[model samples]
Target: MDGKTLVRRTNFTRIIAACAFIFATAASAGPTVKTLRVDVLYWSMNIPGQVAMRKGLEQEAAAINRDADKKNQPRIELTPYIAGDGSAGIERQIAQMFEAVKRKPDIIIVQPTDNAALAAPLRAANQAGIPVVAYDQYISGGTLAAFVTSDNYQAGYLDGEYLAAHFPDSKELKLILVEYPHVSSTVERANGLLDALRDYRQPFRILKTYEAVEPNSGARAGAQMLRDFPATGSVDAVFSVNDGGGLNIVEALANAGRTEIVVASIDGDPKSVDNIRAKRLTHIDAAQFCGPLGAEAMKIAYALATGKKVAPHHLVPVFPITSETLQLYPGWGGPIPPRFAKPWQARVPYWEGTVRPAK
Candidate 1:
């Protein structure tokens, strides 16, 4: 062969070898590791259910980061902001959400403080292409990627049903309410309780409605209720929207030696359950799977981040803890309890919340 031809062939061989080397390098390089920064904004930290929920989010996020293969999915970085611990906490939550929007996180998971206040900021986030997951409470005006919360209405209904069953013989049961109407969950509970009483064919007069869903206000409400209905047979029962305030109200009533007024409340708080066991004023408490609610919110966010389709709403079932059903409860950190016992069965499946698309 000619020398020039031999040199051309050698150069061609070198080019082929270079192409093979490039291909091998590209093949060995794995998928990029991604990080999803999540901003979690909640109304208050003083509540047990809220605290348990945040813990659940952290736990589930950690598990997602560790269990997921790095090459396949993204790691989660959670940033949490809590509103101040008082009635004025809603104002702080509004400010924090504005800040969260400014920061432009991959996602925002929030438990709204005031139902209608977040409408504007949430809409702003949507306009900016950021997705949101809401749990425990509904924020009124904005479109959400997903929402997860306890079946609050059913919880209240169950509490009301329990109260109605106890006072079966009375033609008209007189009840007072310890309620906070600021958020959808609490409001739903109040409505549920009233509806249950109505459905049971047990007529009731809402003798008084006092506003409070926490300890201090609850105690005040309880004290006032006692004074208002000073007579022994004036008030037959009281329904508290949550155990946070309900428990305190019961203490006040019990201390005042007003044991005749039976109480029904929501939130499967340990103290409330103990009250039931000790036969205190709290006869039936509707328990939320608080931890699972938070975990479900995180799981929904993760699904959205990874391009997986998810339902727009998720509803977790609540458990009713009377002294009879207390043994089935696994407390705030575990997943929701399965179907057990009649009449207290789920209103909707644990995974069955769906918000239909607009026409």
Candidate 2:
């Protein structure tokens, strides 16, 4: 070949080599390291279940990062915000939700203070293309990418069933109900308890229903309940919505010398379980898998933000704990007990649904 033709062939080879170099660089680059901003908003840090849940979520995030590092994947950055105090916590949470939207976070995990109160802000967040995960308390009116909570209805049913079995011989069982109506979980729990009682073959009467909003208000409500129903009255048992309220109710009963009254409630709080082990007035507590609830929510949120398939609703399992079963439970603040036999042996399973599609 001529010198000019040789030069042309050399230049063509160089061009092909350059293209190959570009292709190799692109192929070896792998996926881009993505940064996901997650806002974790809680109604109140004072709530034991919420506190445990928050801890679980933090641990989950750390675990996710560690695993991602090992597998050469992206990491998550969480921004946590707590409502100032319980008294005005709901309003503060709403404000925080709006602020989070302004900051444009990729996802939000929240434990709503009220079922309907947080709806508007959460709906707005959905409209802005941000996914929201409801943890602990269910938001009745918002669009949630996923909801993670214990089977509150089942817990209440179990508590009521225990009460029925204990008082089977009584012809007319008089019971006091302590409930918090604002929260969806509490509402479901209350309804479940009542329904279980209704389904009981024996006759019963609801002596009174005191609105003990939460554990914080338990003392006052418990005290009032004691005053309203004298020890000489026909009060057989008390079904409180949660362990917090149940503890206060038990205290009031003790103070009023009304130790004969049996108490059943939700939340497998450690203190409450200890009371059972010690043979206190509180008989049964529905133990929630609190930490697992949070951890599960975190996992679902991560899948959702990453465009992976996730269940729209996730129900953590719960079981009943009494004096006989206290030793078998691991309490509500952690995962299911390794050695304890699960009473309700089936999982609710995850269901598919979008948080809320755009209008």
Candidate 3:
């Protein structure tokens, strides 16, 4: 071959080899994903929020993974523990909390069964340098990396407003308040209802504040209360802290052939919406955005787990749902109402810190 042709061939081979070396180095330097282990302790699968939280967590994890793929960041891996229904399950929930802590997961997200029962285990988790994210309900004495929940107090307050505006006409308003004080969320709800009731122009007395936590217990209490006040004319209105208790009250009143009582409550359970649609005694339900609450908790947990700065408290908003307004409401275990538009006003107070000062 000619000398010039030989030189060109040698140069071409050297350039090809250099290109191969560059490609190999680039492939070897590809991004690494940081995987985190997240432990979730659900109070009860029967409760809507608890179950919805699981769904929301999965969604949030997917979003996080997608974003992580784009930015090449960490991905979350969740391990969930569900405690079943009723008062009988409280002990089991506590046991599950301790068990989760022992596993030493990087982050623990909990919907506490009782305000006090889960505190110890949560404290232990914190002591071990594991961040705890409280969802739906707060743990009174634990160190939390973040707290995410519905604006429960606002939920009850909104319910009370709905009842007060459309409250039944009675010589003297006799209201029955169904409450369960073991959890902070319920207590706030009860207080919010009372706060709104206090603004009412009419004279009203709380006939009784029955301690019923869930629907079954609420039903039992409602039945007993009805028996005690069997006259069918006693309670002018009923304010239950959650939808479960409100449903119980409706059932008790219906069986007794009384349709005079107006029921207002929190938790937008699908059954409660159906009752409203059926023109039952239930009047209003303050719908909590449970999916959003769960999603926010997942976000906060991810931030805490990854050593990022986050707010001490993150609150999901709530809105009032009535038979008239039901068509526009969106909540858990139900389809988004017909022409649902985002409730900008409901979100403003929470986002702008206007409501935080009141709490």
Candidate 4:
């Protein structure tokens, strides 16, 4: 070959090699690594939020792990600390969060006992540059990095509206409000229902209100209420703040041969949906977005860990489900919508699944 041709070929090969090297370097230089720790404070793993986390809907940790695999980000490790139930247990959760703060977790997930219990610790965490994200129930008026939850008050108001619509002609409406102690969600819901009912202006009497120590305690409370007010005639409606509690009320009413009483509650779980199908339960203020709530919680945690700005609160919407519409879709009891079938998709599937049946 001629010397000039050889030189030109060598230059071309060198240029190709340099380009490949630059491309390789750029590919290797991916996103930065960020280490974040998350703690989940909740009553039971069996509930919807915990269940979503367990089922992997939040995907914060998973997203971090994926980014790590792609050489783009750091690994996020989540540690869950479960508090059994009620005010005392939630107090213990606050103690655990204080201890976690010392370890310096980038973010912590809390279900506050009330508006006050976790205020100090959260403030301390914020002052120390750690972000706090609360879920299910929020600790209001604090430096909470983000509050992820459904519109609980609206859910309760919807329940009240449903009851009012169902019993429009009643002159004197007798009802029982069943709730659980230290459950901020329940408290807000019950209060919202009472607030909505105030517009009725009828001779409605709240015969009594009862507190259930556990979710299942609603049955006992309902039965006792029935026995106590049997002579006063039948209850027009029973408003339970949660599905489990509502189911308990239904069971109690059934056992007492008072199936005619309308039952309503929030959270459309499998049993509650079944009860609706069977005509035992009348209404449910459904918050089928627990998965999204978990996802939002993790997203806020990730943002805080990475030193990104996040909102102080996030209010997810809630919907009402009645006996007329509860079973249009499958796996309202299981995770993932019916469309995905084998594996779960993203928020689209969740919204579609929850809304399709209702529509």
Candidate 5:
């Protein structure tokens, strides 16, 4: 071969070798397998939030796991810490987050009781660059990567509307509100009911408000209220923040032999459905409270862990489960009203009973 030709061929070979070398390096450096750890802090094992987490979130996490596995990507490890009571749960969760910050968990799922408790730790996590998703309750003035919950105010307003429709012609109505002390969802629901009822010009009075720590406690408190109030007149309605409280109120009324009062509560658990069936509780406005919120929060957690962008807030919608509809869908909560959209309507199947197939 001529020297000139040899030199040209040598240059071409070098270029080809360099290109091959670059390609090999790029292929070797495929997407890094990220190790994600998620910590879920919840109020109790039996509540709707925890129920959702237990039933729905596992499915979402499993889907994420499947996707990651297909791409030969890092797996996500989810760890849940249940605090059992509202106040204690919040404190324990805060402590867990502080410990997690040190351990550097990729994601933390938190349900704070109120704005103040939520802000501090969330801010600290944000400053440390750990992404946090707040669910079941809203946390104000904090850099939460995402927030997922039902429109609590709307749930409460619907409770009021149900009561209004149930007792349109009633005058001199006496009402009782059974509540939990420091739960953000409960507080929001209570406020919504009171605010909606405030506009009524009828002779309605909030006869009493009782705070109960446990579900049955609300019922006991409600019974006490019933016995104490009607000595002079009658209680037209009892509004409970949740089904547990509402069911308790119904039990209280039944025990007191004052079954005439209309009982309405949130959550469409089987017990509440049974109450509606037996003509004990009049109305139930159940949100996709547990499963969807739990599942979506985990989705947000996975996104944050993988450094993906997510919406700042996600509102899970709720609907009313009345007596008429309950009769149609026996053995579970009634069908979602036709006016609602997807996902919200999809939740009707999940909350048919107290025990559902795990997600």
Candidate 6:
């Protein structure tokens, strides 16, 4: 061959050999995992369930990143947006979803504030091919890759069942629901509570439904509840959806020097458990496996991001923490206690259970 032609051939051979060496090195290093970008649209962190879910998600993410270096696992980049507190938060959540869609994240994980309000933005996210994984509360109008949440109905059922067993069947038990109806989780809670009362054939009448699910609103509702039922024995029981605002009601009743009302609530908040232990107004508190609920949500999101098939819905079990079952719970970041009670007849499926909480 001529000198210039021979030089060109030599360089081409070297290029092929270098590519082979690179491939061999990569093969020895094991499989490559693609990192995913996830945006989190969280409702108010004021609620204890959201706080625990956040903690659990962070812990699980850290674990995944730590393991990524050693195992064939993907790492995730998380961007968070928090909606402000109370009913005002519902608007903020709706706006945040549209903004999240603009950013074009690999996955959008959300705790929806209002089921119907989110339909527009969530539907937009769907059209864009950005998968979403929702937790705690559901989004109404989208094809969610996965949805993970505690068995909200079961929590309310536990509260209602507890009240049914204790209250006198002779008179209709005066009932109050410290409720917010926009979100599916709380709505299910109220439904479950009422279902339990009916299932047990307990006589009861709903005195009122005070709109409150956070601290400030709860405080107002609590004080108002007392005004409406001035006498000590006027209100038989109160069932607050979650402890975020429910604790405010508890404190309000306590501060007013009232003791006649028997209060039951959903959520496994530390303070709620404390109230139960102290023999206070919040007699029974049904608790969520909050930390684990968050962690499992992360796992589901990760699976979807990595192009793995995940179950569309996963429901974690909730525990009822009374004075007796308090010992079974080890707090939020937990060695989640085994399923404690017999099966509950709920509207939701029997697949209610949780994974280990991220420590």
Candidate 2 per-residue C-alpha lDDT over 70-188 given as tens digits, one digit per residue, 9 for 90 to 100? 88776899999998545488888889999998899999999888888789988899889999998878786768888888888877877776776677645688988888888889988
Candidate number of the best lDDT: 6
For 200-309, candidate 1 gives per-residue lDDT tens digits of: 77888888899887777878887887788788878888888987778778988889888887888888888888898998877888888788878888998999888889
RMSD vs true structure, all candidates: 4.9, 6.2, 5.8, 8.6, 7.9, 4.6
Model 2 residue pairs with clashes: 144-355
TM-scores for the candidates:
0.87, 0.85, 0.84, 0.77, 0.78, 0.88
* Top model number, TM-score: 6
Put down candidate 6 lDDT per residue, 246-300, tens digits, no spaces.
9999999998888778899888789888888999988888788788888888888
Each model's lDDT comes to 0.82, 0.78, 0.77, 0.65, 0.67, 0.84
lDDT of 5 at 2: 100
Better of 1 and 5 by lDDT: 1
RMSD score of candidate 3 (Å): 5.8
- Candidate 3, residue 107: how far the Cα is off, in Å: 0.8
Model 5 misplaced stretches (Cα beyond 4 Å): 1-29, 198-203, 230-233, 327-359
**Which 10-residue window in model 1 sums to the lowest lDDT?**
349-358
lDDT of 3: 0.77
Please give the RMSD of candidate 1 to the true structure: 4.9
Candidate 2 Cα deviation (angstroms), residue 277: 0.7
List candidate 2 segments past 4 Å from native: 1-31, 84-87, 337-359
- Candidates 3 and 5: which is better by lDDT? 3
Clashes of 3: 0
Give the C-alpha miss distance for residue 305 in model 1, angstroms. 1.7
Across 3-120, the per-residue lDDT of candidate 5 in tens digits comes to: 9999999999999999999999989988667768887766566564356555667777888899888888768888876666656667776776677667778888877655566677
Clash count (model 1, backbone only): 0
